[model samples]
Target: MTVAVTLLLASLVVGLATGLLFRVWALALASPLVAVVSAIALQSAGFEFFAGVSVIVGCLVVSQLAYLLATFHLHREKHSMEDEVDGLPGKHRQKNIRDQYE
Candidate 1:
């Protein structure tokens, strides 16, 4: 009950941070690996097999969904900014901050 909710919330935070902070898609592998480890730990802590499995699945689903959502919004933001920049004439174009750093 309480433990499941706590785990789900933690998973959500982790997923969102991963998506927002790390652009590499390959980093999502952490979710599955963590899920398996959590399941095993729960079983060793006296949880039933089915209960532990269910909790792990829930955490994985929550985290992955959150990661997907954050990434989608990030793309949307980037694309929208690009569209604004593209409509400007070359003489009046804003210098991108990224360009300066590069």
Candidate 2:
């Protein structure tokens, strides 16, 4: 139980970070690599074949969902910031997003 929870948490964190900080290609490459690594680790931990497969599947699914959720949040945030900039008064309005920060 503890191991399962830890695996899920670790996968979620990794997915969220990668989604936010890396490109889609990198995340695509990472999923299979993580699966392979986790499989070996689970084998050494003495998990049954089916149990290990299930855990691997759960980790991958949870991680991918987390990545999708994080990306959606970033997309929404960007749009909201753009909308805020559009609301700025004409004389004070800036063309670029960086201006919004200043």
Candidate 1 residues lying further than 4 Å off, grouped into runs, are 24-28, 78-102
lDDT of 1 by residue, 1-102 (tens): 666777788888888888898865645576877596677667667788789889998888888888888899888745555457666534323456446677
lDDT of each: 0.75, 0.79
Best-matching candidate per lDDT: 2
Question: On residues 31-57, what C-alpha lDDT tens digit does candidate 2 reach at each position?
Answer: 987688778778777889899899999
Q: Candidate 2 clashing pairs?
A: none
Backbone N/Cα/C clashes per model:
0, 0
Error of 1 at 102 (Å): 25
Q: Estimate each model's TM-score.
A: 0.64, 0.71
Error of 2 at 84 (Å): 16
